[model samples]
Target: MTNVKRKAIMVSLIRKMKEKGSWTGETHIQKCTYFLEEFLRVPLNFNFILYKHGPFSFDLRDELTALRADNFIEMEPRRPFGASFMPGKVAEVLETKYSNDIDKHKEQINFIVEKLANKSVKELERVATALYVKKNEDVSKDDMVGQIRELKPHISKELAKQAVEELNDYIKEAEHNHIIL
Candidate 1:
């Protein structure tokens, strides 16, 4: 798909996520977008890397800025916390334009939004990082824990281990549900 189409889909997905009343924060939006592109084959291609809160993308941030500029989404400032996202005037039109494609992947979208959107930012950091590690496939469990701890020194070793285990379970569930191939 064209970049324009992909972005329209992203904006539409963001709007749908907001309507669910579950994914309001910037972190939730980013991670949900990541899962849509990376896992559910939505083709947003945002160049994510393992940042402080797990996979982050400057490209995605830019797209969000564009969305704000285009009035497709509104950002509500939260002081020390990051801004929350709400649907803007253009959201409904974009959503309707992309509804069929979005509906085709509703199960994966819902799974991602419901499962990860409600987690605290810290917990999301752990989960997203663990999933990143799991994606490498060759990384041993011990190595995964070490990597997670090294990246997030504040996290306990036990917690890191648990996160990896939980991520493994999620992978299995996704595969079973055909959310991932």
Candidate 2:
């Protein structure tokens, strides 16, 4: 799109976001980001960003970067969104993705978070165990059997079984204890 057209789209997005804090529709968001990167290049600031088709808003910079990927927003060199109004569960995983520790696991964690949001801690443990099984498949058949074998002394099957049963509970307990760190 031409610069003028991009500007027009950005202006339109700005008007919508100003009125309701977001714009919805695939073409709108993609085109909006296609322009926003340029608009933002001027060091100008706005309270809202047109995140996507989800009328969501965020209040951070890094978060904007994740949501503004090439496929998602068509922006380059990236910009962190200043605010988000995504649903809480969706927002949480997005926040965690920008977090330092497990940043790389954002996508997987987001999917799990979505699935786990509706479940009890009891259910989460079942899920975690199931996921562990799938993720660990072929440790004996894949390439990690030797390492697993070497670590077997430190990792007992019995202990792991117990852990599978108690994982969700433990995560909850740790959270209750203020131990997420």
Candidate 3:
């Protein structure tokens, strides 16, 4: 699909997420969108790379900025430092316009958001970074924790181990559902 269409779909998807009480924060948005395109095959062409916060895409950021500019979403800074994306005035109109496409992928979107919605940003960072490590390296499950810490020295070993376990769970479910990861 064209970039324009994809952006419209993203707007609608975010609105749906908000309605479902899944719009936790920016990290939620990033990870959910990553799963939407990479695992669920929504085809938004985000060139994700293993960045500090795990899978990140400049294209996604640009699209979000454009959405803000168009008043489809608003970013509000939370106390003590992070931000959240809330639906703006135009979000409902955009959601309605793209209702059919959003509805088509609603199952995947809901599954992803529900699975990931409650995670804190730190937990998400650990999980996403661990997933990146698993995808890019040939480390065994036994050594996954150490391997992850080697790349991301700041994470506690306990958190690294937990992240590996969480990533394994996600992988297993994805495989069971025949969703390519």
* Number of the predicted model whose TM-score against the real structure is largest: 1
Off by over 4 Å in 3: 20-23, 137-139, 179-181
Write the residue-wise lDDT of candidate 2 on 30-104 in tens digits: 323322322122211323333332112243233334444322222322234223222222333433343443333
Q: Which parts of model 2 are misplaced by more than 4 Å? A: 1-109, 139-181
C-alpha positional error of residue 69 in candidate 2 after TM-score superposition, expressed in Å? 33
Please provide, for model 1 over 1-181, each residue's C-alpha lDDT reduced to its tens digit, 9 standing for 90 to 100.
6666666677766766776775478788878877776766666678889886888888888988988998988988776677888878877787788777667667777777777777778888887887777666679889999988887889899999988887778778888888762
lDDT of 3 at 154: 88
Using TM-score as the yardstick, the better of models 2 and 3 is: 3
Predictions in order: lDDT: 0.78, 0.33, 0.76
lDDT for model 3 comes to 0.76
What is the clash tally of candidate 1? Answer: 0
Worst 10 residues of 1 by lDDT: 14-23
TM-score sort, best first: 1, 3, 2
Relative to the true structure, candidate 1 reaches a TM of 0.89
Q: Model 3: per-residue lDDT, tens digit, 121-145? A: 7777888777667767778875788
TM-score (C-alpha, index-matched) for candidate 2: 0.20
Angstrom error of the Cα, residue 19, model 3: value is 3.7
